[model samples]
Target: MKKLYILFLFACTFGFAQNPGDIVITEIMNDPVSVSDTFGEYFEIYNQTASPIDIVGWTLKDDGTDTYVIVSGGESGTGTTIVPAGGYLVLGRSDDTMVNGGASVDYSYGDSGHTLGNGADEIVLLNTSMVEIARVNYDGGVTFPDTPGASISLDPSSLNENDNDNGANWCLSTTPYGDGDLGTPGAANNACAPTCQTTLGASDTVCDSSNPGATDDTYSVTLDFSGAATGETFVVSTTPSGFTIGGDDPTSTASGTITVSGVTEGTDITITVSNTGDGGLCDLTRDITSPVCIPINSVDLELIGIIDFTVLSGGSDGKAIHLRATADIADLSIYGIGVANNGGGTDGQEYTFPAIAVSNGDHILLARSLTAMEAFLTTPGYNLFDVYLEDSSEPSQNGDDAIELFKNGEVVETFGDIDCRPSSDGTTVTCPNYQFYEDAWAYKDNGTWTYGAAQCTDHDTGNVPSTWTTFDTPCVYPFVAALSTQEFSEGELSIFPNPVSNGNLTIKSKFDGEMKVKIYDIMGRQVLTAEMKTESLDVSSLRPGLYLLNVSLNNLSSTRKLIIE
Candidate 1:
């Protein structure tokens, strides 16, 4: 009887105390966009009970070799790690926001002991005695949000240890955190209740009575929703254009058509359907886009080429994009393009195509300057591109910048790694992070990307996008002989020691009087600006990479690509 009583006491001591579900892993940002994986990985845990849990000696591990003991809390290197009663705490690869993808890390697992896999990974927490507490294994596949730049978050309704294990209880965080990746770390996860899914249906362009004829068209499309219940209200909104939300706006979850009047010919509109909210607790948002109006094409539009032509001034004035239409688009305004500008990602649609129409075989060119664009065309000038628009503010790209193509305020495609810049080797090849195109260009053939020496391939009746030829000498496209002989009436300007390794860079020009000099980095950020009378400028303070030297003399100004090694 005494032995039985002792056994009962032992069960009471271990069973009711420190159990597995005491803490739960709620969020995981395995793939971070603002910073590298080495310093950006992080996860959040919540203490489920009404008692504070001191996790100072707890161990964090994955299914594999990653394992680390918490020697600290609210500190990075080492300290006490604690989870407040019913509160959340964040542990990450680094505690520095500048390096950890803008997350406020509560405790940092040293770089040596932890890493997150972008594909499939696990987060397991254990007690000091090595007893398993809680765990979550997420396969970065269909059931989870595999988008690299965002975090996978647990639904607020499923914040418990039991529900979080279900992949269906998580989603890609839509809330933008610091530096632009999406996730809520060190804070409560976003609510994912009254969840709704959206699908865009067929779209058509028709004459709008508001304009009296077909001169102005209204593009109408249908939005089909699922998983939304009755009494749930959905609000609708559009960007770059206004649209009339038809059936189900502020009503039940019935599908309906939305009509956008006075539609621009060459751009797309983003239609947002959102729940009115259960006073903000059960809100849902889904952004749907207008169809590409491609009757027979399966995928959306494609980016065919990236050009950095060496114009008359040997400047990147010829920065542009080439595209071919897959279907006869009645309105081209449904598409837009933006340069990621250095490594910073997704500066959404800086240039929107104006209202226009094009045939299935038409070739379109979006250029930063039409004057510079004419210099790269057929012999006389302006003969290749079926449609062209010059937007001085857009396609303001350098050799290493990434490009994003937007449809309805969303990035439907990208040309390069929007988050990676050219490394010290003059190429992203070290990381294969982003495609490098300096004294070269890239073209797409049969949906595959191919890089070649900067060459001219004007439209041909036979090859369509036209095959390019490569030449390794003279740093200029051989076809430049047929380029327009447009001279700079403002006189000539040049730079000596063009690829300046160190010391001063000398600016040579006919208008060599007092000049306003500005040097901008590859990202278009002005780093240095000054007014000087002499030609020599000190550049020793600048880092080694690509820069643009903009020199203004009297009323004339010129920009040239300056390389620093």
Candidate 2:
């Protein structure tokens, strides 16, 4: 009889051993977005069998560090722990009631010695006899990636315990359960689907015009789609008026290059691609600013002159530099070189050109003040092609300082040397360079350095003025007429309402062959430029300030002062 009793006990124990797939680890909130791990961390177990399972002696553990024993009732253990079939049991930190998106906390594991890791860890569920029921070794961003504020849920369609272990069968929860957060903690899992994505390829910068000295430009971009249906058609388009598509409207391929032409330099351009056939998933857009065309060589630009000092007091007009381009160039950069006045080493300042195009023979003035520079010009009412403000040491110097021009970080031209000792003390002391009077100026004449007399007067190219000039009044250089005989007729090219209040300022030219017009602000920054085939040129986009307008026809050009209110 005793032998029979022992056999019956062994059978009962074996029958009570829970199956491995009876209870599955269905969802986990290992990484909660912005919430404290102690309060928001949790793991969910779903009873997958057809009957209720008594989990009184079941244990939930993480990576052998934490173990939570299933108890009957509250924290102290009052009743049996029973999980109904198809029901969920959430075990989480008990410090906060709102954790895990406010789901009903089935068991408190707050005092557990271990915490869920955001990167990777293992979660295991065992029966009373310490037999493993289910285990998941999840890698934070790898096998089981983190879904901050959302729980990682197992697909309901694949409810087997073996499926739960494989991270591929799991996904981030999409159901909004609590506090506007995503995760179906105590509910059914959300349906999952394969996603298709589309992306834009790199953009290309190209000259706007194919002409030999063209500086204005546009760009081309390609669109690529993945996981798209066969024979899918996409429509490519661009924002703003300047851009145009080069090919047919609809393309029936996964990847295609879209030729974007006529883009305005310096303006932001956006390219969009959409599925034309079904108007479905493959739709996306990208933005890029039209880039300036850079000069290929330094020979394309020339540093022509410098207005070291002006009679005007304060502001940028007090100092300035001049440059002329022999070919159409864009994005030209200039740098100033000098010895530190603070008794330090060499000092340098730099300026870069914008996307505005500079045509051949275009003269640009970089000044301390466009207003003051214009005010000091001997040629009254003449506009500067461009004016740029210098943030570096003022071009005004005492002949000791040097100014260096750069193109693409390479030295193009240099004036003066910081190491040249031109002056000496009576005894043994010597200075690096001599100093010039405040009213004196220098210019590059016929490839030679020429110093002007104290009083302003335009002189031809030669280096003789370096020793012949004496200090007197503030020296000045007036704009020279174009050497060509195609000069515009006097008063032929004009802009109405000299001081325009509305943004719109119209340009009217009497001599009308193809005319290219450009406007510059006092700082020497080109604000607008366009090839005008018509009489009307718009100045409405210019800010309220003093500006110079240069209108060129063939080899001839004229300038006029303009004011925008």
Candidate 3:
């Protein structure tokens, strides 16, 4: 069996009356709301202190510029409405005719393109007797002088509060702008928005090595090679950067000798190489007989807006939906394909010839710009944007080069044959370093391969090993953990609009057996509880705050946050 709980008429036990002086500005809708209509913004006042005050003839003014007087007919008397102590009252747009729908308000005022400095603004709350009850000059608006200043709300929701302004730290200072670290605001309201930060590119690693095995031989793989975050782990480019190799004179400052560590016989190892600052013919080879050298081809994909995809090749017409990350080169060449313009209604489409499917292992997905892709398709440029990896059914993949094209199921271009060099004798060749090339798939400069274009060739071993050894590493591609033919079960539980409303809460949960639903304030105080099993709770009686809703079964428990307006 299940149970339900309800809390009703449980408040208002004390005979409290709201007094004129008891009204405190609960919130201000605009911290720096632009002065669009001048008489549009309003103030919300709550009766926190006990006593109901007559507000029949009270005048409200902002910054001593705009004045609004409350009236009944032509004469002012006791306030038409008596706000009980601990109650809510709203004052809306000074246009008397516009009544704020059931929402809480104490005073209402609008603005008209009138800019207020980022400093203090004046607010006066008068009583029906024409006497001032609340008078406070709030230090809010755009900042001034040397220090930047903006409004910060007392409550977390950030609704601006003017009266009963007891707490400090309700201001965002603008003094720190233009310091290379903090950017300045454009408009008055812009000061209260979120701030942005500066970040370095993935290829921007310092190449100067610490330890010197010989002279240039001593290199830090971590510093020389780095990888970007993608849906799957794939090689961007098979190139290293920055530091140079020992006893070898290179054109650029950053270059290093190919050093393979942590390798064992009869096992496969993936090595990434990146040339930081120097540009030259660089490749890798396998010496061991037992370990077979596999040629890894870096696959790039481009998609725009929303589009549908199906395999036309690879014998998977209906049986195959291109897995997120799969490492089947032949399959990728066949049905494993990519699409552009998708459904976004963009222009032009470009995708690699072979689209790799998702498997149990890890795979990398590289995204590049259309302009860069066009250059790659038309001209030869090495603008290796970024390499982000994706695995399994993750909702989103890492960020990389973004493209704005369109795709509607038409083979427009082909991913040309990737050329690789061979060592002398041709007996053994360097294994295609997927991780390395994935990092190197950047844009080229003037047909010259850009060095230090970022790569993932770091070794985690404490003491670097001289011999190449294979270790258990994560899959570097998109894959599926499980294939589902049935939908996931909700188990006698349901949540709608996930983020609910304030005051009027509409909850609907169901189960065949008996269940219990309860609501509690953030402080663990049980505000409402019922044993009816399934029903909605009239949360209008609750205050505007964060509350937790707990639904319990025989042994299972689920919780969700209830936001009251």
Best by TM-score: 2
Task: List the candidates' TM-scores in order.
Answer: 0.34, 0.46, 0.22
* Highest lDDT scorer: 1
Q: What's the lDDT of the predicted structure labeled candidate 2?
A: 0.61
C-alpha lDDT score of every prediction, in listed order: 0.67, 0.61, 0.34
How well does candidate 1 match the true structure in TM-score terms? 0.34
lDDT (tens digit, per residue) of candidate 2 on 114-221: 578787888887899899987888888675647777788888887788787777678888876556557776677776553334555666667554333455554454
**Per-residue CA lDDT of candidate 3, range 374-441, in tens?**
22222111111122322222111111212222123443222211232222232344323111122222
lDDT of 1 by residue, 1-565 (tens): 9999999865543332169888889888898878888888888998888666878777788999998777854345453376777888888888888877688788887575878789988889888788889998888875666788888888888878889887778888888887888889978888765443443455555433333222343445455554444455556666754656565553454455554555553346666655655432234333434333332223235788787765543455667788877657677888888888778766777888787887765567777777766644432334445677777666777767888887666777788888877653554344264456664566775666765443332224354432222221233332222222232254487677978977689877775478778886643357899887687898888998767676777666665668888
Stretches off by above 4 angstroms in model 1 are: 1-17, 73-75, 78-80, 196-565
Using lDDT as the yardstick, the better of models 1 and 2 is 1
Q: What ranking of all candidate models by lDDT puts the best one first?
A: 1, 2, 3
RMSD of 3: 35.0
lDDT of 2 at 239: 81
